[model samples]
Target: MELTTSNPAQPHGMTWLRDDRYSWFLAGMMWVLIVLMIVPEGFDYQRLATASAPSSGGPISRMLWLLLLALGIMMVSWRAGLAWLLARVLNPFFLLFVALAIVSVAWSIDPALSIRRLIRLGTIVLACVAFVLMSWHARRYQNVVRPILTIVLLGSIIFGLVFPALAIHQQTTPELIGAWHGLANHKNGLGALACISLIFWFHAWLTREVRFLPALTGGAVAVTCLVLSRSSTSLAATLFVMAVLLVLLRSPQGLRPYMPYLVSMLVALLLIYTLAILNLIPGLGTLMAPVTALTGKDTSLTGRTEIWTILSEHISYRPFLGSGYAAYWTAGPVPGADSYAFVWRMGSFYPGSAHNGYLEIVNDLGWIGLLCLIAYIVVHIRQSLQLLEIDRHQGALFLALFFQQAITNLSETHWFSVQSVDFVIMALATTALARSLLEHRLRLVFGQPQPSTIGTSHGMALPLARESFDRTPDGGA
Candidate 1:
């Protein structure tokens, strides 16, 4: 009934759905689902020993996926305007990337595995879309995400201290024996979550969205967990994001015009760093000696360089289309088997990922996929800069998270993984960009009319501020 009467001009319809109780309930459920995906308590580490075995998630996970899918369908069906909004907001490059993943199933070395993983990926995408549509209001983004990070950060600290046997990793090598995992399956997972929590809480504090006491407490907890996890990559990424945030907040207006140049330089630097890490550049190891010493890591990067060496050879075989979506890593035919054997022999255990996002994309979907990702990032960065002109606080938050993920992928791959936390943040960034683009277009087509302020009292402000850009008809362009 609501779907039939929904109007584009009155996009925020279904007044009953805007009830405080319903909004909070939806937010809580979505947050819980995200946490479970990132820190799956039922994950079986033993499965890592067998690369060829069919991996199965817990019943709880299966049910959560179904619920998320159902909710996504319901939201899109009930809010026809949301469908229209997404039509204009969704990035074409990202859609092409997803399409390629689906198409890869036909050529996949392990068709069954590809299909299963693709299905899981579809579920995650659906949930992300649902979240974006549901939170299509200014400031709702912070309100929805803040409590989630706070609860997760506090809960992880408490669980790690109270249940060390369950929350801390015990089977790690003697050097990493005391590392804390804290509800996640691995210490690295905990570290990633902590890094994310630190960024969110810090942004909240900087924006004064929450009281000082809670924000400071949450940030402290996040930092402690990050340190205890003993993940050098996470620590480095957290610091990198913080530094970027500091720069952005210091002079957002002055920095806006140079954002494109800044992003390009950052990407170029990352490429050089990657090459250095891979030993492709002679004498690079000597240059990185100081960094290694600071992080207490050897030149091996804990065997990631070796994994990259093996996977690089395999990427050349199917350099165009790849071994299909996540199909090459399994113990299958030819190159897949060879690569798996090499990694197992080198590490005496499963390596799990390519340890590099760019390499992973090439391995899963080939060079075209890699290009699609680059295009997606370029577009996202441009849009985030535009957002900074209007909403400095929210815009800075998006950019900081985007940079953090970019850096994190250098040492850990989560590009297209199902229910991956990094991928989810990327999705959220895409959603924010889409929302901003839609608003700009609307202002252009509809003229600079005052937005209906029906939901402002409920903490939902229509995203129609004209503080950033010129009001000329072609200004949005």
Candidate 2:
């Protein structure tokens, strides 16, 4: 009898797993998942109403997401091994915050609702973790993400033009009458998508990732949608992030050391402006008046400050641990229900959030939760800044996304919302940056070959697996 030795890591008939096919399939699944999230139920109004009920996601969608998570976990186990995957996903702060959310159910005003929302949030975070582990290269990450954003942007435009009744705001508030919601349930949703696409396509153009004409075309589409949606917050956040990205990406290498200081100054200015917009800083309003006017908003920031004032009172009730994870807004979805007391006070409107991420965190998880979230963001920011020294393009992209999220969160809450597209991307970006930084440090310590170089851009090329298993070549990272 011939003695055949087998590797435990690679069981018999597992040769099929040595290719990039799984990566591509996972990327496609991610695209589908994002699409399902941003554009739900074929943009059918009635279906959207039922789907948008308090539960973060419908049953079918949750199951599909979980299925994708399972496939991703299995792929990581087979390709990179669970330990390698864990190294990327075991972010301490993220885990702590999640654990806090889970434990908060004990004190939640509505434990059942908290439990349901917590389940959805858990799925989202895990899905993001899997996306990070499976995405072995920055270029692959961009490839999977860019097209999804572009298609959604373009689809929104087409939807607005072809189905005006469904896509355009109808018998709503006087100011919002003609605003375009497109395939999204709200105009701000469409605007947020457009803003992100604009930033991405612009970055693609800057880095020559896509042809100039195609990038320009994508940006133009995004701009059209942004203008039609009339989402001032998205517009402002998009501009701020784009400016930061341009300075970081286009500046000469000689100025890299000073980039941090420059960015700090910019962030300071942003902080002051955010405070002014929230009416927290009475003095800076005059300084920001011109800029705010350009965005077509009044001193009240379209009544957001008022909402903050009202929500602040509620937050004061449970200032420490919070009302419980997603428990504050437990009222029925009716127009004039008792649960909408805050909403009615704000504007007799339903914004579905505190209009601020920091406030949302405080309201949901309390000051402790806010501290954990800030720590989480700080850790990712440090990683991205360190990444700038190793890979400019990827680092700038990550940093830009972080800044955009920060800016948007000033006027919109996406920090922990299960249905938020921005939160999803932010999670993916955080994990990718963490993985890349960890890999770079490990290589330095182990004296392994530096990460594979691609082009002259100093980009980190992460192979899909260990050299022994990455038999199928990838196009590029």
Candidate 3:
């Protein structure tokens, strides 16, 4: 164990630090730290008024803050995306479009523009940096993906579920509405988060990265918190995402046969919505009757269904790039007290967060960008799933994270919001890990030949590789 001194040209006893495996471990560690920091920020960031944020008066310049981090990430990741990751699966234009979309946010007219910019920048840029760094390490080591992600998720549960419950119970105010606050802002976030965690937990158990005992407990807490949040949309998001994941990972003999879970979850959601509409659920209508009778309005949904009807008209006008980024929510994404006009006019709250990430893309970046985004989702999901099915290291966990985010995106914004920290890190880091896991699985599944080892830099798939980017701060989040 004795260590020898070394000359400037040669390394000393810490030679393992230079090993590719250590690099990967450090990368994973970096992402875990980033998520831990970001998740806390999400809970508190929304409390500040726009005037309190950095560069709060700029017209559309706040976007620069967000993009700066992405640039920093790209710089750190020495491997550019043009190589294999993008080339192997993507059309390349999607990456370009994401860049354009970031640029386009500058034209947004939201009065809180500067504050909005800082908030988004802090959330997304930080996430991008963490992900890129993790991805780079993963490029070489490949197998550390699962354990690293599991660490983030377990830690998230501590804040997202456990702490929120304790905080709610401690507060004596009758007006206090306690719900799951996992990385995002509301109960819907908890629902989405619960589903996401459940997927990861299940994935862990399924792949044996984690034991089953803890998985059930974690999954149960998440789902229970979602139920307490009382958000129909979020509740559905949790069940549907979980059901989909179970289907993907389950064997024919597994519980509910997977397909049944899928169908049952969807049916359950449809029934709930339908019941809400028809006033048909057992006691729901009785409760609604009194509330509607008292208010002379269908306060349920806070009138989002109605607003969606009205907004559906505008959505058609500029099917592409409608209004601008974070636009359209002049009426919120879900029913709530957030949008005064929509809430007042309809006697309920308009939706916040647009309720759908895909539609929001079409509405914000226009059809062109939306198409590219769609392609990315499709390709990414397809590639991720391929890995999940093979039962490799953290492959299923990656798919679970992606699925939870995508499914929840229908009714909540998990990509770049106060609640976005953990999921974003989980998605990006896990996905990068999944790429290699998939390749390995593919090798195993088909008994294919192994590729050359890492560091054969010539023509290596390095596009968007996390290591290619640097963690240099750009006076940003």
Candidate 4:
């Protein structure tokens, strides 16, 4: 009997379904899900009381969860072999952190709350996985990101103007009464989204992949939202990322050599800033006084120091493994006595986040968890630089994102939160790093030339693993 050979380009019995239209449709659904996940208010989830609690299995939330699960199932079915996909995508440090979160349930203050939040976190990770699988192709990946952000940014502006009550937060402090939330639950959320959109669009413009007018329009929209939201941290982080990007783009060949010095300078600046905030250095407060006046804040950073003081005291109670994920901030209509007092000190009735990502991680998982997170970030940074060597445009984008997250984390707590836009962006960067590394490893192992997808040009494509598999005679070993 003669053996029949299958077409290497189409594997896993998906050849019949391998139409560009199908891929685009799947990607479109994934993009919509991302927008919904990041900005739930865009879909009016904020209007539903059921979307309030982390542990509340409300109908709307349950339905959304089912929808996400269905999407993941569809992606896995289309791709075939979830196990193999996961093996390639999973980063050890990230996986370890997730594992730690799961084990934290054993020691959680509220076991039920911890389990529920863990499930939500898992859902977010799985959704991210599905996204990576669907948009594995470079052009497809850019298509997924660019159009989604453009629509979201433009839609935010339209929604804010048309439905001010829903899109803007009216209950903010007097200083922020007219601030535009723009399809988000809070003004800062809009600001953060705008900041990242600015970075993405700016990269697209600088690379000249898109036409000048459209790129300029996208950037303008992002800047307008960012300014209207009045989020100082987001604004500052955006500017900082832009500066770093400019430097890297100008001297791509010198990036790796200067990375060590750049990292040292950043650490030094952080230390000086911390010292100045704590008044540990003489005359530092005086030096910062002018800067503070311009930013409309005091040396105390508008009571953030007080909140940090309170959190630091509580952190000592569980130094190694703090109150389980999202456990400490759950008391009642009001927070527990200590947290309530902290909020009262901040002149707010509700207990909010630590407002510092590092502190929040320490509060949730302790120093050990924080170290794991640091390692994960370092690995990603190194990997991002490696990608830059092959594809400067994509590398610069990844690095800019990394810096933006790092800087924002100094003042906001979105490191590993469920369904947070910041976390989702971080997940995306991590997925890209994984893809880059996988491509490099496969090239080394098989002694094959790098695919055309790896580039150092304006339109650099992603070196998709599927392409490598398809090129093989027997669909890869």
Model 4 pairs in collision = none
Best by lDDT: 2
Model 2 TM-score is 0.83
**Candidate 2 residue pairs that clash:** none
TM-score: model 3 vs. ground truth: 0.58
lDDT of 3 by residue, 199-310 (tens): 5566566656556787676666655655654555555455555565566556465543343345435434433433454333456655446434532445334444554454
Whole-model lDDT, model 3: 0.44
Q: How many clashes show up per model?
A: 0, 0, 27, 0
Question: Model 1's lDDT to the true fold?
Answer: 0.68
Q: Which stretches of candidate 3 lie over 4 Å from their true place?
A: 1-77, 80-97, 103-184, 220-224, 231-234, 252-303, 313-317, 327-351, 388-399, 415-419, 422-434, 437-477
lDDT by residue for model 4 over 213-328, one digit each (tens)?
A: 98888889999999989888788878878887777777666456786467547645654554576554777877676546655567666667877777888888998998888767
Please give, for residues 121-233, the per-residue lDDT of candidate 1 as tens digits. Answer: 77667666666655355666667765676676677778877877767776757646888877666678778888988998888877787889988888888899898898898
Give the CA lDDT, 0 to 100, for residue 22 in model 2. 46
In model 2, state the lDDT of residue 53.
42
Weakest ten-residue segment in model 1 by summed lDDT: 459-468
The predicted structure with the larger TM-score, 2 or 4, is 2
How high is each candidate's TM-score?
A: 0.83, 0.83, 0.58, 0.80
lDDT rank, highest first?
Answer: 2, 1, 4, 3
lDDT of each: 0.68, 0.70, 0.44, 0.66
